[model samples]
Target: MIALDIAIKNKYYANSTAVVLKDIQFSVKPGEFVAIIGPSGSGKTTLLNMLSGLEDATAQKLLGNSKSLHDCKEYQLGYVFQQPRLMPWLTVNENIQLVLPTAQERKIKTLLAQVGLADKGDYYPKQLSGGMQRRVAIARAFAVNPELILLDEPFNSLDAPTAAKLRLLLVNLCKSCGSTVVFVTHDLSEAIYLADRIIFMSNSPSSIIHQVNVNLPKPRKESGSTELAWQSQLMAQYPQILSGSVSTD
Candidate 1:
């Protein structure tokens, strides 16, 4: 459903130029969920922005449904940022409804309920916890019934337990809707649990160093037998972490 041939070069710092991304080539099949994990400043967000068509592709081209990014008619993109980015003045239901572009009240209620916010639709952003607000953000994204969703650290603010639960909920929701998801995170365990394939990038001026298929079954567990093996693999792939003691699960 999505294809990218990206080559990004920028001088964010001094006179030295940095090749943030280099001829990065990848494709996402319809209804597939792919996770991108990398060290900080590894251009993961940059890649996501390009894929979402929010940022101008520097030296790359994206084709979806065999059509260029500009020509693809089926392209409906939704984004979930690290922050919930909810409007404080709006109720949770209203927040989600803002994106629906529909007068269907039933649609808003159904979406709020889908994200486990049925009872909280009347509440405002300030009245809810961080996780709840994020849920509202998610409902807003999925409420649009997007063909492609770009999630950039969607669970960054939540506690471990909350984050883990939301991760699974998101996976199931996407699967049921047949939405293609490109999730970006620095969390290895989150990636392993939620992704069909995990792409790892090295440090700054980074490129895809490893792409491992998560052979585990769907609805992954936090304490699974293969968890340790995946952790070991990521640790080995990580450059600065020489200890190889990083645990993912």
Candidate 2:
């Protein structure tokens, strides 16, 4: 289990009076996929940073089981950014090797195959298309075999078709790894499709405004009628969420 109750203070300010995230609270069960969505500048990335131990929080109390965030030495983390962020100098296989330096060559090849890039492993980052580079990044993230994965709108920049394909790949990878995921996305439909629970946030000085349990069955299809119906019902019930007005203190 992962639990967080923290507030992030602006590091640039001397007084530290500015708080970007205001006492945000939530928990993620093991093997659960949670999506965080909010308006622009709502501190979604800041929250992810805090969770990943990249930033410090004031009066924070984050616990992963019996270990606190500061001392959770056993936890393994993986991150996929909006951009692919691959090393241009490395081949597709070598980029993955950068993470799992000792992983077997056969295992690396299998990962490439899983991401639909089996034949492209020998290609350099510049040789691949934008979407393909992102696929390589995804493959590298999973290669770490992290216990928790953080995604910051990895598909936001892709066209609809490409993004949909990556989403499917992500779902399959998560299921196979049983890794707990905290995905931050601006797209409501994507969140609805991927998250086991959606944690909605307020604007800057953000806090948890509400949490919506998806309650959908496993192996969700993006275009299936069930997904469409759920999306319609969710939007109908909380139209403000789609419009970035769900914040209520």
Candidate 3:
């Protein structure tokens, strides 16, 4: 069975004649990591929001192994936003526990350790570095061992070294838990590194313009030869892919 089936017919702000998303449809397989890449302002975050149930998904015709985000009573979803969005007043450990009051301290401890923040649990968000805050956010998302995880540029704005470490950590955790992931990003190289398949979205009134499978070995190294070669090949084949200038036709 598919992990998710989404057919978003259209999205428009109230009383606005301009359209944001149109005829955007795709399906994610169980345990597959899919990345949706597009230029900024292409509604990638909006789509993630709809999937998370933070925004209404009435227009999102989601099905198969799941229902609309609001009525998806059986699907356990996790999300890591562009910002860590941690509760400033809450300690890192407490932020995780807040999401799952029933979660044991031991379980939370293990998660923090997995994200490489074992000792920082007692520290509040204000006391942690940006990267540290993100670690807590990720730990909180994984606390429930979600069936599907949605990540919105989770590594955005981090230093290259830090982002690379987190990417490896995120992928390793996803592999261990076997969670299907849908990550949205504007970075083609990042998409190539993390995704099993990458879907390119067109400019506004967006729809998927292209989809390419990455046959590279899993847990790829940053700027690895094979990874770089594959990326180069894709770029050569479709120079306009990243800029959202590729034709949806």
Candidate 4:
């Protein structure tokens, strides 16, 4: 269980204080997948940071398993950033292995297979396509077996088809592993496709404008009426979400 009662009293600027995120409150159950989406400059990444205990909340509680976030164990988190952020010099297998606890080569091979990179493990980051690099990044994150995973637009650079396939793989893996996912993305369709619930936020000085609980059945079909309907519903709220803001603390 992860909960964040987030409120930002004030924020820093070049010469003064400004507010970024305010009155942001949400609770995520174990094994639930929640996606946060907003325009650029919104507090999406900042929000993730607070939830992961990389930043402090001005006047709210951040809890992991009902305790303070900072007090929680570090191993509970598995983060995948927007960029692959992999070392160019490291082979795909080496990169994933670097984050894994074991020295077993089979573990690397297994993760590569899971991310659809089994044949590309020996290739370096520079040798892979953008989507492939991201796959390697995902493989690294999953290798940790974290209970709570945070993803920040990890598939943004991929084509729609590839992205959709990866999303399916990711959601299925999360379900099978019983991992709770807090993913940040700008893609509404992707959110509708993979999330159990979608949290829509306004631009900077952000807060939740709407929460659309995805009612689509599991193993979400890429092309189907149910998924399309939910996607349309979330998209309909985009304009309102972009134009509003909420006070934090």
Candidate 5:
């Protein structure tokens, strides 16, 4: 059975005549790492928002685990957005506690330690650096042992070294949690390094245009040759895949 099955018929703003997404359909197997890449306006974030219940367009619908998201109440989902969105007033530990039905001290501590923020739990959001705050965000998401994790450009703005480190940590966390992942990013190399399968979307009124299975060996590094090779090969072979208007086939 699939962990997620997205089939959005159409999506557009309430007052707008333009369509943002259409005929977008795909299914992700349990524990699979899938990344979605597309141009700037391809509705990638919109899709995530809908799935997370952040937005509900009258004309747009999404199915998760073969059932509507509204009805999938028994399952757990975690989301890490483009920003950490931490509560400045709350300490890191408290922020993580917000998601749990009951405060879990041991689980919270383990998550922080896993993200290299064990010592910062008592610190407020403002006390930590940008990267540290993001780490806390990740820890918070994993605290509940989510069945699915949705990440929207979570590592986009960090320095290269930090982003690379977090990427590895995220992979490890996914494995330990056995959670299905759906990551959205514009970085081609990032997708290559992290995803088992990469799904490409078209521009506005986006749809799944192409998909690449990344069968590279694991323990992947950001600067690893296998990832670079795939990047170079894909760029040369399908120059317009990122444009979302052309077919690599």
Candidate 6:
């Protein structure tokens, strides 16, 4: 299980202070998929950084499997950022190998195939399309068999078709790996399709305003009536979710 109770403060300028996040609290069950949805500047990425122990915060307490995040040295974590962040000089295969040097060549090749890039292993980041690069990042994230995976709008840049394909790929990988996933996205429909639970935050100086259980069966179909219905319900119930305005004070 993963649990967090944290607050974050930022000094965006010399004279002013901004509380990017306040009184944030949530938990994720083992092998569960959770999605965080909020406005553009609501500090969602900052929350991810705190979970990954990459940022310092004033009142941060993160727990994983009953151990403090700082003390849980045995848990393996993986991250897929908005951008692929691949090494331009290395081939696709080399980029994944860089992280998992002990992994066999055949296993690496198998991963490439899983992401529909089996034939592109020898290509560099520049040679592949944007979506393909993102796939490489996804494959790399799973190559290490991490216990917790964090994703921050990894498909935001892709077109609808590409994004849908990647989402399916992600779900398959998550099912196979059984890793706890915390995904942050602005797309509510996407959230409904992929997450077991959706956490909605208010505007900057954000706090969790609502949490919705998807309760949708797995292997969700893309763009079906069921998904559309849930999306409509969410939008009607929480219209401020996508474009939020909340008083920080």
In model 4, the clashing pairs are 22-248, 23-248
lDDT by residue for model 4 (86-200), tens: 9888898888788876786987788788888889988989988888888888888888787888999988878988888788778767866777889999876778778889888
Candidate 2 local Cα displacement, residue 95, angstroms: 1.0
Per-residue lDDT of candidate 2, residues 210-239 (tens digit) = 788999898888867888999888777777
CA deviation > 4 Å runs, candidate 1: 1-18, 233-249
- Each prediction's whole-model lDDT (CA): 0.75, 0.82, 0.86, 0.77, 0.87, 0.84
- Per residue, candidate 3 scores C-alpha lDDT tens digits across 1-249 of 138888988887547878888898888999999999998999999888887877667746877476555674666778999999999889988899988849689999999999999898889999989998998899989997888899999999999999989999888898888898999999888888899999999889888899989999876878899999999888878888888866333
In candidate 4 the C-alpha lDDT for residue 107 amounts to: 77
Prediction RMSDs, each to the true structure: 3.9, 2.7, 2.0, 3.6, 1.7, 3.0
The candidate that wins on lDDT is 5
After superposing candidate 5, which stretches have Cα over 4 Å from the reference? Answer: 57-61, 247-249
Once fitted onto the true fold, the runs of candidate 3 whose alpha carbons sit more than 4 angstroms away are 64-66, 247-249
Candidate 6 residue 165 C-alpha distance from true site, Å: 0.6
Q: Candidate 1 residues 39-155, lDDT tens each?
A: 877778878877777666634667666567655656677899889999999998788778776776888888778788889988999999999899889888888788888899999
| Whole-model alpha-carbon lDDT for candidate 2 | 0.82
Q: What C-alpha lDDT, on a 0 to 100 scale, does residue 14 get in candidate 1?
A: 32
Question: Model 6 clash pairs?
Answer: none
TM-score of each: 0.86, 0.90, 0.95, 0.87, 0.95, 0.91
Model 4 stretches with alpha carbons more than 4 Å out? 1-16, 57-59, 233-239, 242-249
lDDT of 5 at 220: 81
CA lDDT, candidate 1, residue 136: 87
In model 6, which regions exceed 4 Å deviation? 1-16, 101-103, 245-249
What is the C-alpha lDDT profile of model 6 across 1-249, one tens digit per residue? 344333343413224575777778788888889999998988899888778877664345677876777676777888999899999999999999998848579988999999999999999999999999999999999998888999999999799999999999999999888898999999888898999999888887888888889987877887779888888886776555676632332
Q: Residue 236 in model 1: shift from native, Å? A: 5.0
Model 6, position 214: C-alpha lDDT score: 93
Q: Which 10-residue window in model 3 sums to the lowest lDDT?
A: 64-73
